[model samples]
Target: MTGVVGALVEAWDELRIHRLRVLLALIGVAVAVAAITAVTAAVDMLSQAMREQNERDSGRSVTLQVNAWPATAEAASTDTEAIAAQYDLALERYGIEYSSRTLYSPVPVRFPDGTRGVDMQAVDPDLGVINRIVPVQGRWFVDQDVDAFAPMLVVNEAFMQSLGLSDLSTHPTVLIGDTDPVRATIIGVTAQRWTGEMPSAFWLYDQFERWWHVDPQMGQPAPTLAVWVPTDQADALSERLARDVQLAAPGWQVDVYDNRMNGMSGLDGATRWIGLGFGVFALLLGGLGLVNISLVTVRYRIREIGIRRSFGATSARIFFGVMLESVVATLVAGFVGVAIAVAGLKAVPFDRLFGSALQDTPPFPVSAALVGLGAALAV
Candidate 1:
């Protein structure tokens, strides 16, 4: 232990005396370490954001939609309600929290100014799964509104701007489904949705009775009935739904989109490979620096090393002393590099660059310390 301490002190002294050379080497090491940390940190943040977005887009619970026709047009149709109940039971049996909603095809809102586009979605008020819309403005619909003759509507930002409305709280009048222009208050704006299939819009299930207007609800020109389900159970639910639909109506097609399956699912394996490549490159660079620094120290301290050996110092001690100096210099550089990277990252608007997807990510971990220390010693 005393010998090790003596060697460490001597190594530290040597490193101090060659301050300029050590500093230059440290800078290279620090830069590499910092780069590694920054890249890894960014990747980690993005990965987490993708996961969260997936969860938000494709709920953690599984959902299934079934469109069944009544045996007779006048026979009180309870099949749709019954099938929904069965789905709910199956989900509960699987220990999955589930919710469902019945939607009308998106309704086209024709304003007096000739702005024609589909913007409204009618939904069940009680279903909690996908009913909660991230409101950028007012509030979601209440149960009473769903039953009212003239129900309230929630509009999106794009819809509001198109209608020449400045504030959503002003209760703007808009036309729905070729009906006479009815006045409904704008309750909320949707979070900027990037889906290519639908234009920006708001909820209006309370105001319009979509089922009453369309014949063979499935044959209607608009998309109706969206069900949200858990990611893991999405495939199973989709299969079950297909089977249910076939049993009920063989001519209708069932479609499913598991939000969890979107955006960079295959990238995990690619990212691991990329990370490994960078790590190997970093290791090689560190090793090269270590060899160079160690050789230089050994060459410069031939006389000192000889004297130490004469005084009973072993070759192992001399080698270790040189290695220790290199290790310390490299570690110091690594830490400095990590600090600079962290500070620099704060200056960039990462949220804007990556989108709202990663706005609330946690700070990068300090595990880079281990990497730094290990790389320095290896070098």
Candidate 2:
């Protein structure tokens, strides 16, 4: 141990003496490690951003969507209602924890100048959880929001702007319905899906039903139920749910499908491998450059090696001492590179890239730091 310590001290002293000569090589190592680590972290963040975006569009992972329609055109309106009731019954029978009923309908809203038609979604409270809905202002729907006397609304930025409002601090209210025009309160504002997105709003299913009834003759689509279940059980429950709904409403076409796509995970995996491939290529190029510089450094110290050989330094000790110099230099560079990568990750504009802030921003991956350090040691 003492001999190893002395050798390490000697190696460090040599590095200090020739620091200027090794500076360029150390910089190469640092840059290479930084590239590997930053690329790895960026890939992770980008993948997560994409996954969240997908979740917002579709429902969360492993969500089952149930839809039903009468097989014959002669089916009565009561049959449609029965089908909807059966969907709810199936959900209840399975004791599904996260479920929602979603319906899209266009409603007339009184703007400042005149009334305009606005697209609205009437959804149960669980839709917020199933769809990963995050409001930029105020809060998402809660169970109690259903019981409010006035209809509660969560509108997009464009919808809020249409009302000539910038924020929800004043508790804004807008007249809804073409004939009756029940005053509805805007409780929250969400970001527009894209720039110049048309005005849209969301309402509690019960409140929407109590106020504005959507008629099928008006070209409105029927409400569909979404139930979030475990991935392992999605296939099994899909068939069972479909069968149950079919049994509840005989002579109806009932279908239950997994709404969330499985492609996101595969896409993320591909991105990780591609990013790592490029990182590895960069590391190899940097390593080659560093090796050339180290060779020149060794030649420059040939005289020093000869003198140490005469002073009872064995060939094995001399070899290890020289090898230790590169190891120690790379170790120092690894630390500097990891620090730079961490800072870069924190500085990245995640919201701009992902279209929204990530609900769960991952911490700096320990694997990234390990990859950087491992590359340094290998070089």
TM-score winner: 2
Model 1 clash pairs are: 61-229, 61-230, 62-229, 62-230, 63-228, 63-229, 122-205, 290-379
| Candidates' C-alpha lDDT | 0.60, 0.86
Model 2 over residues 230-325: C-alpha lDDT tens digits? 988899889998888778776667788786566887899999999999999888887887799889878988998999999999999999999999
TM-score of 1: 0.74
Q: Which stretches of candidate 2 lie over 4 Å from their true place?
A: 1-7, 217-221, 260-262, 310-314
- Compared with the true structure, the alpha-carbon lDDT of candidate 2 equals 0.86
- Candidate of highest lDDT: 2
TM-score attained by model 2: 0.91
How many clashes show up per model?
A: 8, 0
